[model samples]
Target chain A: MRIACPFCGPRGSEEYTYLGDATVRRPEGDAPSEAWFAYVYLRDNPAGRHRELWYHGAGCRSWLVVERDMRSHDILSVAPARDMALARGRAA
Target chain B: MLAEKYSIVSVVAQALRGQRGWKPVWREPEPRAEYDVVIVGGGGHGLATAWYLASQHGITSVAVLEKGYLGSGNVGRNTTIVRSNYLLPGNIPFYEHSLKLWEGLERDINYNAMVSQRGVLNLFHSDAQRDAYARRGNAMRLHGVDAELLDRDAVRRLYPFFDYDNARFPIQGGLLQPRGGTVRHDAVAWGYARAADRRGVDLIQNCEVTGIRVEGGRAVGVETGRGVIRARKIGLACAGNSSRVAAMAGLRLPIESHVLQAFVSEGIKPLVDGVVTFGAGHFYMSQSDKGGLVFGGDIDGYNSYAQRGNLPVVEDVCEGGMALMPGIGRLRLLRQWGGLMDMSMDGSPIIDRTPVEGLYLNAGWCYGGFKATPASGWCFAHLIARDAPHPVATAFRLDRFATGHLIDEKGAGAQPNLH
Candidate 1:
């Protein structure tokens, strides 16, 4: 599968390293252990649409949030993770 | 009554009678309104669980509900390699028990599963890898499981066709498990189903469990496509869809489903005598009785429920195969298929009671489920029948993830794909 990187155009999926579940946000330093456990281990792991983190290690070396269908491996959209985090009111 | 016992005399009698006396292997039965135990998923593990529950625990009032036909899941999709060569204390005993169960499976079930103990060898390419394998082999020996460390010349003497002289990643040695090999993957489900059926366990196919009926924090029954069937106890043996099914009961599992692909080449003369794993890469291969080279590599390294994988993994597996044995490059691949793996955070499986009362789970198998089929069933049956964790499976507690007692076998913490 070829993923369209915002900076490097389209590249083979091998160039990108996959880290799962981009939807998870890091909890505060003193957050409850339950929150930290969920952040570290739990996952929705939906069979349908999923937004995941992919690092463009072989390309622009930037982390991208790639929205794709887990059932079909079809890429729906791609954006820089920092931009998405900023837009979601989280610190970049 | 139980079906006719299979033996050499029975085979000859059947041949003389033109095989007309052979009955159906397992009976088809309608789901009853209630059962003592209800098991979700009719794959190898589910069927085996039913069999063990009936035969060992005397809990014959059991039902196994399957969404599809038997052996349609990872049981049939796996490459069929079985081994107990492990390192960790929590894993070695469990898998060793499974291996011993495999040794007596066909006789116990009265079915020819073709359980071949042809040995499994893990090749080492470097000094550090050799040292690691030596440590693993020593651990297996300490546990009374058969393990042998072979030198480079010893490996060369057994299999002379390897790319042993390659400048990069030259073959150093191997760790051999003589009792580890392959079984007929499909026959495992069939045999277990028939055994359980003979013991009065209901094998219900095409019965999809849509929802789990939870009454005041206890699972009472399940809402299936056919009808609501109540049970005193419920066991979830659903492998790939463990997280999804558990969600039906208002629970989330520490599992991520990833697609793992297996490939087979066109039937040729017997080449690979036994299972061989490439240490430098993730490829493992064995020759089936039909002469097809049954092999597989790593998972797709992504969260996916799709039963199909991308080309990158296929290419990577082929590259690993070529690097190990150059001769296989000439052979064309005949078939390739994928199965969803319920990869757990610690790369180990969980077979314990959930927080919800009367609800048990048997999931997080990752890539190791096929080999651990019998012991998983045995342990799960013990758990469901007695409401207690099997001694060997005590480490697979559901609360371990929350309690900081994770059995990180691969040392890859909290990453399902990495495991």
Candidate 2:
């Protein structure tokens, strides 16, 4: 699998490290324990069309939000995770 | 009709009768309208659960529903190595129970599963790894499970072919479990299916559960591709697709499905005597009775429902294999396949009732489900029949994630891929 990193262009998947579920947002410090638990443990784990976090550690060293199909391992889109977070009004 | 008992006498009699007297290993039965219990996924665990429910719990009115044919899932896709060498108080007893069940499985089911107790050796490279393995071995011995800490010379005596002088990770010592070994993976499914069928449990194939029917917050039945089938109780042994199936019941699990690949080399003369694992790397290998070397390394380290893996993991596994045993670099890989692992947050399994009424869950096995097949069924049967977690499986509660009682065996907290 090759990830077309927005900054590094196309790179082999070996250059990137996988972290899961870019959709999961960190809860507030004062959030309820149940809310924190869900944020930490629960997952939709969809079979297709997953947006996940990947770090281009070997090349550009940029964190990317990769939209890929879980069923086919097909990369649909890639964007800088910081830009995506800022666009969603999440503190970068 | 009940299946005939398998014995030497029966084998000779069948041979004399031109093998025509032999019946189908299991009957192809139509789904009943209702059953006392319904088990999803006709893999090893599902079939074993059906058999135990009928034989041990006296719940013969059971049905095991499979979307595909029996053994089509991870049951047949694993490397087939079975061992109970585990750490942690919560895990050792449960896996030890599974190992003991594996010991008596062939006789109990009257099937030759080829349960070979050759031994499983985990080789350590560094002094720290040796101390860690010694601790794990002590834990296993304390639980009455067989474990031996072998010195480097002892490991060399067992298998002299290892790269003992590798510069980066030289072999120093190892941990040996004498009772752990491999079984015929496909026969496990067939044997359990036959035993369950003889006990009057319906083994329904090509039955896809599309929706789980619930009434007033109580699970009543399931809407299948064939038709709706009701049951007083439901058990989800569908590890690969656990998240999707549980969603039909309005539940989300702490599971991420990842692809784990296994490979077999071209048939060669028997070389490796038992299972040998590289502690520094994730590679483990054993020679099958067919003379093929069966081996695997880590999972692909990503969330994927695809029953295939990337080339990078293949390269990584081969590199590890070459580093440990350079001689195997010449062997040609004949076949490689992937199985979906239900990686739970804690790196352990969950075998308890869901919040939904009349529903039980047996999933989150990660990549270790094959060895736990028998006890998984045993505990899941106990839970569905008695509405309580089996003694050994109490730590696998569904609410443990919420309650912060997670059984993180690898100490890799909340990271499913790392586990």
Candidate 3:
């Protein structure tokens, strides 16, 4: 499969690493047990289109926005997260 | 000696050559049918993908076809270590999200997938390794991940028995990642399967894929054991056999199979507290909560679906681990297992669209598949469900190999100590 990363450009699926389901958002502290479970392990497992997160570890080592068909690997678009595109890691 | 034989090499060798009871008989070809979505490989990634798709995106009709039981592939064979202290901007965040996901996986999936954060450390003896650790620690700090640089004294404090002043591969200090740990690998797949199954997804076990029925540049369905299950879309989570699986669609993923072995010592008193990796020793060891020593080493440099590897890497790993922790040298290894690591040329992962219209891929994870389970499912699910790449995984595309835009992480100065 072809993955179009933001910094590394479009590369083969072999060059990137699949992290996991990106939909589960870990709610900040103080959420209920159901909310925590939903954020932690709950998922859609959609049969059609799904929005997920990926990492292009073989290239720029950047997270990728992989828009693909769950029924098929037909990718529609690839980009960075809403706020993370501008976030660059710094040396501690 | 660095070049010697391991105890359980014979069994693994037989398993690889189709001698043992578990040779993979790929599903034969059959008529195609059309369904909404189909996920190949019943490993952790594929099952998690199904779970995410059905639960998050409201894509109800999904099928996960596994060549074997839930995680009989690399999922079951991996050395279930979990850490997010990556130096790369992309990997650090992606793995950090995965680490967070692991903390609550058991409760979330309603399965006891023992995710433990017992701390992990990468010992640095050389100036170059130290520099790399500093850079990596900085990246972790930047991403709000818990990481720190420990001096030799701190290292000695944490691990007193380690020979701090050894003449060979001296331990100067280490980069400590307190949040890193291990999990029950097989349980991860089972837990995800149970969760997905509970949410109304059909998991067809022992269903091998003979061919990807693609028509007019689109994936029509798959030929499986239960006959042709027409899938509107397909996700390839086949790791070790990724190349063969993709070839059914007439595509060759740029992946080279490498055999990776892991060993476990007879249950002894817990001699180690956390995962200890020798930066220069090409070895790493982690004491399971049950007091067994989980060990692994560098990837056996060869290409094939041969799940068994040569004995040299195993010996090297044990040598390195023993060199660092001399106190554990007397413990006998109970068993050792080998798995095929679907190693990509660039030493990363691929999660994107294929040339075929209806097929997506999430393979070529190399030796890091276990830790990236949740995140891989999330990204692959996003790519399949929304028809768009997540903002985070923008770099790993199939075209990168063709264009020479590889994310080579196995080269010199790589943040991963084992490589």
Candidate 4:
């Protein structure tokens, strides 16, 4: 599978490290144990159209959120995860 | 009714009678309206759970609902290796129990699973790797599991064809377990299914579980393709589909499904007598009874529900194979298959009750699900019947991750793909 990285254009999957389920939200430090547990452990491993986190180790070293179809393995969209986080007002 | 005994006498008698007296090994039963216990996923683990439930606990009114046919899951797709040479305290006893179960599984089920106790050799390269093997072997011995440390010459005497002189990764020594070997993967499913069916457990095929019906925080039944079949307790052994199936009960699991592929070469003369694994790379190989080299490497480092893999993994696996054994490069690759592995955060399994009442889980097997089938079923049956974790599987609880008791066997931390 080839991922069209925002910074590196297109690259093979071997160049990137997979971090599953980009939708997970880390809870605040003062949050309850259940919230932290859900954040740390729980995942929605859907069959199609999954947004996942990937780290480009061999290229631009940028963290990306690649929207790919899990069933067909087709990459639909790729953007910098940091940029997406900032757009979502998640960055500190 | 007396179960058919497969023996040479029966074979000869059937041959004399034009081979017409043979009966079907298992009955294809229609799903009943309700069952005492329902096991979703009719793979090896599910069927074996039903068998153990009947034989050990006398729970005869059980039903195993399969989304597809039996043996269609990882049970039929694995590289058919059985070993208990583990290094961790949390995993050693559990797999040792499974290995012991595999030793007597044929006699217990009265089926020829062809459980070959040849051996398993983990080849080590550098001095550091040799020490690691030594430590692992010693740990296995501490757990009362048989393990032998082999020198470099010892491995060469057993298999002289390895690329030992390669400068990148020179072969030094190995860890050998004589009792650890291979079993016929599909026959295990068939054997367990027939045994469970003989005990009046319903083997319902093509019965996809669409939802888990939880009533008042307790699992009451399942909404399947056939219909809503009620059960007193439900066990989820759906493997890669564990997350999706558990979600129906409003429960989220710490699992990500990844595809792990296996390959088999065209029929040739016997090359590998037992299971052999390379130390430097992710390559393990064995010769099938059909004279084909059956092998597999690492799992595709991506979360996927698809039962297929991309080309990169294939190329990487072939490279590992060539790096270890150059002679295999000339052989034609005959078939390749992928099985979805339920990779846990700590790379261990969870066979325990969920927070929801009457709901049991047996999943997060990673790539070691096939070898753990017997003990997993036995322990899962114990948990379901008694409402507690089995003695050996005490550490494999769903709450372990929450309690910071992760059994990181490979020391790979929380990364499921790394484990």
- What does candidate 4 score on TM? 0.97
Give me the displacement of residue B359 in model 2, in angstroms.
0.7
lDDT against the true structure, per candidate, is: 0.94, 0.94, 0.76, 0.93
Ranking by TM-score: 2, 1, 4, 3
**What DockQ values do the models have?**
0.81, 0.91, 0.02, 0.76
**By summed lDDT, which 10 consecutive residues of candidate 2 chain A come out lowest?**
A83-92
Query: lDDT (0-100) at residue B408 of candidate 2?
Result: 88
Which residue runs of candidate 2 sit more than 4 Å off their true CA positions? A90-92
Local accuracy of candidate 3 as per-residue lDDT tens digits, A1-92: 57677677777666665543455566669876656544432234333455667777778877776766643456678877644434532321
Kindly report which residue stretches of model 4 are placed more than 4 angstroms away from their true locations once superposed.
A90-92, B1-3
Fnat of each prediction, in sequence: 0.77, 0.92, 0.00, 0.77
Instruction: State the weakest 10-residue window (summed lDDT) of model 2 chain B.
Output: B403-412
How is the predicted docking of candidate 3 categorized under the CAPRI scheme?
incorrect
**Which lDDT tens digits does candidate 2 get at residues B1-419?**
88899999999999999999988878898999999899999999999999999989999999999999988999999999899999988899999999999999999999999999999999999999989999999999999999999998999999999999999999998999999999999999999999999999999999999999989889999999989999999999999899999999999999999999999999999999999999888999999999999999999999998899989999989998999999999999999999999999999999999989998899999999999999999999999999988999889988999998988878989999999
Q: For candidate 4, lDDT tens digit of each residue in B188-305? A: 9999999998899999999999998888998999999999999999999999899989999998889988999999999998778899999898999999999999999999989898
Q: For residues B1-419, what per-residue lDDT tens digits would candidate 3 score against the true structure? A: 01112225745876688875542222222323555889998899999999889877988688888877778888888778889877776577778888888997877776678787889899999888899899989989988999989999999999899988788788889999999988989889877887776666777887899888988899988988778888888999988788778878987565645568888898888778888888876788888778888888887543334466556666778888778888778889898877877766567788999989989999878898899999888888899999998776767787665555667654632121123
Clashes of each: 0, 0, 93, 0
Which residue pairs show backbone clashes in model 1?
Answer: none
- Candidate 2, residue B224: how far the Cα is off, in Å: 0.3
DockQ ranking from best to worst? 2, 1, 4, 3
Kindly give the stretch of ten consecutive residues in candidate 3 chain B with the minimal lDDT sum: B23-32
